[model samples]
Target: MSDLYIGLMSGTSLDGVDGVLVDFSSVQPRVLSHATQGFDDRFRAELLQLNTSGPDELHRAALAANELARVYALVVKRLLETTGTQPAQVRAVGAHGQTVRHRPQQFDGTGYTLQLNQPGLLAELCGMDVVADFRSRDVAAGGQGAPLVPPFHQALFGQLPGVTAVLNIGGISNLSLLNASGAGSLIGFDCGPGNALMDAWSQTHTRQAFDAEGRWAAAGTVHAGLLQSLLSEPFLALPAPKSTGRDLFNGPWLQAHLQSFAHVSAQDVQATLTELTAQACADSLLKQAPDCKRLIVCGGGALNTHLMSRLRALLPGCDVASSAVHGLPPLQVEATAFAWLARQCLERQTGSVQSVTGARGARILGAIYPA
Candidate 1:
C-alpha cells in the first residue's frame, strides 16, 4: 500500500513556503505534486526583524505562526485537490516551520534553537497528522540538528559505488558525503553562506530581494582581496558535524567584514560574496572529502548560472551538476526529503545519521501531532 505525505518547508531565506506531496511505499518514494507559496513583504520584514529584535517580537512570531499555518493548510489543500488525495488517505504532513533563531552553543546554559510553528494549529487546520519540531531533539542529543538531508541523500543517491557529495545551497550551505558502501557511512555539515549573503547584499544595494540569475554579480568584477578577507571568517575553518544559520550570516556579520570598501559598488560586493560562497564550498570539499568523485548540487543556488560556473571552475576534475541530473529538482530536494523523513517517523525508524549529526546514536526524529 502507498502512503501520501505532505512536506512543508520555510527556510532562512524567508522567501516562501514549499509544499510537496509525496507517495511512499515499502519500495521507493515519488513526488506526487508540489506548490510554492510566497510570503508577503510585511511578513518577511517582520520575520527578519524577529531574528534580531528582543522580547517584544514573540507576539509577532505567534501571529506569524498562525499565518504560516494557514498558508501550509492552503498549499496542502491545493496539493490534495490536484493529486486526488484526501486527508484520510494521507499519512501525515512534515512541517519544517520557520527557524527564527539558532544559537547552538549559546553562552547561557539554556542553549536552544527556535522554530516558530504551531503544529497544533496546523493539524487542526489541515485535518491530518503533523510531525514537526524536527531539530531540538538532535541538539538535545549533542548534535547540530541541521544538514538533516544527509540520510535522505543517502537513501536517494547511495546506489553508485563511489563517493558522492550532495551539496545543498539554501540560506546557508551544507554538504552530505555519502559512501556507496552503506547507509551508515554518510557524513555532513553546514559549509557557510549560500544565497544568504548575496541576497542580503543585493537587497541592501539594489533594493531587490535577490540577484536574479546572479546577473548583478556577473556584471561586477570580483575583488580578490575582499574575497580573501571574507573567507578568513573562523566559521569556515570550523570542524565538521557543525551547522550555522542567519544568526551567524546576518547584517552585523557583513558589517564587520565591510571595511574601507564602503564605497565599492553593490554589484561588486555581490560578486565578491558569490565568489566567497563558491570558494568556501570548494575549500571545504577539498579538505573534508577529497575523494569525492561526483558533486550533486541542489537548493536555490543551483539555479544561479554564474554560481554554477564558479563551482565548476573551482572544483575541476570532478563531475559537478544539479540534482536534476539524478532525478531531483534543485528547489524541491529539501521538501522532498522531509516527506521521506515523515515516512521514517511513521515506520519508527531513525531518520538522521549519527555520523552527520554527532549524535550518540541514531534517533527517530520529529514529534507527531494527530488530527
Candidate 2:
C-alpha cells in the first residue's frame, strides 16, 4: 500500500511556492518529485500589499486567493505530470497559504492570524483532498500556532541520540529542539528575523531579491551599535510558544532601526542584519538548549554562505549544516513537512505535540477539504 501526498508551501518570503510529491510507503518517506513556482512580480506585489493595510482589501484579497489557488494548481499539475502521478492516486495535498498576518501574542481576546487561502477552492481545482489552515486550531487552544514544523522535525530528525535542533530560517527564524534526553519532548519557538531584514535592504539598494551567498553582507563591517540596538528587541527575550512574521519585522520596522544609524553604509546595515540573525539564533540555543551541538539548518538562509559562516563562528564546536546533509534539502523540508501533516490528518493522528507549540495537548491540526 502506498500513501502519496503533495505539499504546497508559500512561506513568509512571498517569493514563490514549493510543491513536493511524496510517497510514504516505507519507514522513510521518499520524495517522488518536487518543483518550485515563483510568483510573478505583479502577483507578488499584491500579496505584499495584503500583508499590510490597503484600501479595497476585501475584494483584492479575494482575487489574490483565486490567483494563488490557480498558481498552486499549476505547481501541482507539474509535480504530478512529471512524476506520472494523478490526483486520484494521491491521498491529499497539504497547502500552507501565504501568511498575511500573524499576531498570536495578542491575548486580549481579539487576536487572530490570517493565512490567505481558499482551501476549498484548491480542492476543487486540484481534484484532491486539501488540508489547510494548520495554525488556527493551535491559536484557539491558547498556543502560538506557529513553529508547527517542530513535531514534523521530530518525526524526521529525532532519532539522533542527542539534542538535535533543526533551525528553519525563512522570513523569520525558528528553533525546534529535539531532546533525546530527559522527557524527550521537542521544544520549538521563533528565534526572530532571519533573512527578512537583509532581503529588504538588499532589494532596496542592490535591486536584488536577496543578498545571494551573503556577498554584500560579507563586504561590510558589522555596526556593533546598530546590532546591539536591534538585539535589544524584547521579542528576542520572550519565552517559547512565540511566533512572528512580516507583521512585526517588516520594512518599516527595519527602517526605524536604520534611522538611528544614519552614517552606516547600506552594506554595513546588511552585514549587521546578518549578524543579528546569527546572534539571535545562537542566543536562543545557548540559553535554552546549551547541549544542542548538532543543528540541521534549512530554509533560504542555509543557502546564504556568509550567514552559515557566521553561525558556525558564533556557535563554537557546533556541527552546523544544511538539511541536505540529513536526507532533505533546505527548500524541500518545509513543503515535505506539510505533506506529512496531510497524511497525519488523514489518519486522524495528532499533528503536533503540546510542548512544541504550548497547546493544551497533542491535537490534530488543519482542516480538510475534499475534492
| Deviation (Å) of 365 in candidate 2 | 0.8
TM-score, cand. 1 vs. native? 0.96
Which ten residues in a row are the worst by lDDT in model 1?
103-112
Q: Candidate 1 lDDT, tens digit per residue, 1-371?
A: 45888888889888888889987764556788889988888888888888887777878899988988998888899899998887899999999999988976466633678898989999999899999988888777777788789999988888766889999998999998888345448889999999988988888888988999899999999987778888889989989878899988988888887875677777789999999999989988888877677999998999999999999999887899999998878888999888888888988999887788786778898999999
Which of the numbered candidates is closest to the native, going by highest lDDT? Answer: 2
Each model's lDDT: 0.87, 0.89
Backbone clash count for every predicted candidate, in the order shown? 0, 0
Q: TM-score of every model?
A: 0.96, 0.97
Q: What is the lDDT of residue 60 in candidate 1?
A: 85
Candidate 1 regions off by >4 Å? 108-110, 180-184
